[model samples]
Target: MSVDILIIEDEPGLSRMLATTLGAQGYAVSTAMRADEALARVAVDDPALILLDLGLPDGDGLQLLPLLKQRCQAQVLIVSARDQESDKIAALDAGAEDYLTKPFSVAELLARLRVAQRRRQEAAPVTQCYRAGELVVDLDQRQVSLAGEPVKLTPKEYQLLAILAQAGGRVVTHAQLLQAIWGRHHSDDTHYLRIYLRQLRQKLERDASEPRYLLTEPGVGYRLGDGTA
Candidate 1:
């Protein structure tokens, strides 16, 4: 049977509580008490999401973030006692999609999990052809064009553009973009995003200085230009 969620938490009581609660809600939940065990289970279970706690008897959960991201497509949500801002940012940059400090209410945990599942459902393959002014993205084909001409983009740049395009006109936060592209550990590296955004503008914009399709929201994030000529 397939697992919908994997809880990689070392605390037996908390693990049982999570499993029991989530299972009651009609989710197929799996639990692992150590990092190595979690990795092994992930390989076999093919879970859609993971609830990870950083402190483990064998290894640190934060250290496993990148490996888990590389090995599986599951969305990882960090559940740890480390409440420091640096720890949260580090986890986010390391590839974790969300972080919930300990002492959190079970109701909130369930709500967050539901949101993550909903996003996955929405992002699942359907017909996706995005357009913003002269730029066109055929998501199904993984191709892009500018003013009827094909445009070339590095894998990372394409990923960035694809995310913005997927958002339609809504703003994609810096943390979101960074976590999506470079992993969670790089969330605070806004400079990296800036450098890439400049490259994208140069390649896709008629005038990089005054971009029309790709727009920046100072102190917030970025958005694809509204689909207006």
Candidate 2:
């Protein structure tokens, strides 16, 4: 299927390479070298996925992540030269879906793109229920099940899962979850998120330590994944 993709990289050579490659793959491609231009293009194009390079000329991609997220619901995949563990975690926390270190092969990049595309396709708005493998979250009737058995959940637990379900497997930052559930004043209360997420995992996951549905994004927040991968 044809997909709209945005390449937000500052390096001219790298950006051109990406645009050419993606265009050849049947994707509609656009490029931006600065954060401002990226935002403007996003407003006009409404891309489905964004391949972002952290070291933009105007501002870092880390700084632009939240803004991009707020402006459009495009899935962001950070493709950067920064290979530090901390950089990956920071990008995830800033709301990037996946990270790829620089000097990657075409095969590796294509593999990553496949995963992102699968997630985006799965995340498409559910008309009634959301299914991730055996787990089912019935949005229309407010019910949840695992392995075809009913799963009892508190109002808050169900609410949290509902939010994640609606997200369509994308990472939902801690602040976003807190504000949605607890209120804007409580958006920074990471403690609440920790408690609630833990509780939800206990109920939803076969092994809470190795969660699938209630996946943790380390210092960032959480996302719901099929976990088959």
Per-residue lDDT tens digits for candidate 1, residues 21-40, read 99999999999998899889
TM-score of each: 0.63, 0.77
Which residue pairs clash in candidate 2? none
**Alpha-carbon RMSD to native, per candidate:** 6.9, 3.5
The top-ranked prediction according to TM-score is 2
lDDT of each: 0.85, 0.86
lDDT of 2: 0.86
Candidate 2 residue-wise lDDT, 43-103, digit = tens: 9889999999999989989999999999997889999999986788678768788999999
Off by over 4 Å in 1: 127-229
Clashing pairs in 1: 92-184, 93-184, 93-185, 93-186, 94-184, 94-185, 95-184
Q: Candidate 2, 153: how far from true, in Å?
A: 1.0
- Candidate 1's TM-score reads 0.63
